[model samples]
Target: MGELEQKFAAAFLTEGRWILYFKGLGVTLGIAVLAAILGVIFGTVLGIMKLSFREDGKKTLWNILATAYVDVIRGTPSVLQLLIMWFIVFATWNNGVAVASISFGLNSAAYVSEIVRGGILAVDVGQMEAGRSLGLSKAMTMRYIILPQALKNMVPPLGNEFITLLKETAIVGYVSLTDLTRAANQIASRTYEAFMPLIGTAVIYFVVIKILTLLLGVLERRLRESDQR
Candidate 1:
């Protein structure tokens, strides 16, 4: 076995290099959380903008902008976007993780914006009118009546988006971020024992996402139970 493999195998049995692995894990999770949070916020605003169309000209403009953004982001591969964000947008910066977060945040924002738009469209028009009739401003109606219901509908999809963002973080390795996947890649490169490191990384991702899915499930159940009343 290669030296790195021996070290890893020993570590697997005895907690060697555990600190580095956990540090990488922390970094990966940190980026995923930050990106997903920012993405959702930005997306909500853009989605509202896309939907805020009274005049035909305004509608056309927002539609074109939203459509172009969604199409371009969805059409292009994420890794390429990461590279562009790294080399072009934050060229002078040395922090690879920051670049990764920004790229993922922006890319995810494009998708999450569509999710928000769909959720908003799903809300009943009568409820909006009711809010307006109750002396609520348009903004107040949206904030109080429209958005709350839409947000409930948004949770499942947003959770899925979080999972997707977590996986997408692997791409940060290309920019040399040393995230979980990057750590595994480094270990594999040194050890020449590809399967163990890959399996380890996959397990890490699976466990993290599975935990999130379970938590979201509990939240979904609570939301549904409340809705039944």
Candidate 2:
């Protein structure tokens, strides 16, 4: 066997080292899911506030604050944001997972807010008018009529955001959080076999992203069919 093959065998195919990868995968997934959920909730509120009442020619305090947050987050690199969160914003907090989650969640929210805002704007004005004609208040119209269609539009972009956020969690390793990338790095350092460990990590990420993309495609197709029916 070649030297590379020997390294691979020693690093991954022996002594249950693959378990490290599994554990790292769990941490990565946990961070991604938590961040994505929080991002969606926070982004939805920001999107609604930014989009709402704009026709009235006045901005609310919430809108101003949301706008500033989105701009700051979107304008900054995510790695920088992560460092700031870990070292500065939550300096007193010792939970790496929670810190990583909040950091990525806030970063993801900026993009998600734009996606949601675009989706809501894509909804027809006539829908809101019709709901209003039926005595629905603006809030009721949004909740009952506008939001459903907007949510459908939001799914594709939101799925993309989740995938992006999943990959971004690799940076959590910088804060000493042992995610998949960090686990692979540790293996590389210990085994002195960078190729096998790093390549394996890349393959794992690719496989996960491919599976998620396939699922999202199926969901989009079903939504299209439902709209047709």
Clashes of each: 0, 0
Error of 2 at 87 (Å): 1.6
Kindly give the stretch of ten consecutive residues in candidate 1 with the minimal lDDT sum: 10-19
The lowest-lDDT stretch of 10 consecutive residues in candidate 2 is: 48-57
- The TM-score, computed over Cα atoms with residue i paired to residue i, of candidate 1 is 0.89
lDDT at 193 for candidate 1? 71
lDDT of 1 by residue, 83-192 (tens): 99888889999987777888899899998998999898899999999999999999999999999899888889999899999988888888878888888777777666
Question: How high is the lDDT of residue 76 in model 1?
Answer: 97
The alpha-carbon deviation from the true structure for residue 196 of candidate 1, after best TM-score superposition, in angstroms, is: 0.9
Q: On residues 1-229, what C-alpha lDDT tens digit does candidate 2 reach at each position?
A: 5987888887787778899999999999999999999999999888987875566788878888999999999899999999999999999999999999999998888889999999999999999999999999988999989998998999999999999999999988889989999989988888887889999999999999999999999998887786756
Candidate 1 residue spans exceeding 4 A from truth: 1-15, 56-63
Question: What's the lDDT of the predicted structure labeled candidate 2?
Answer: 0.91
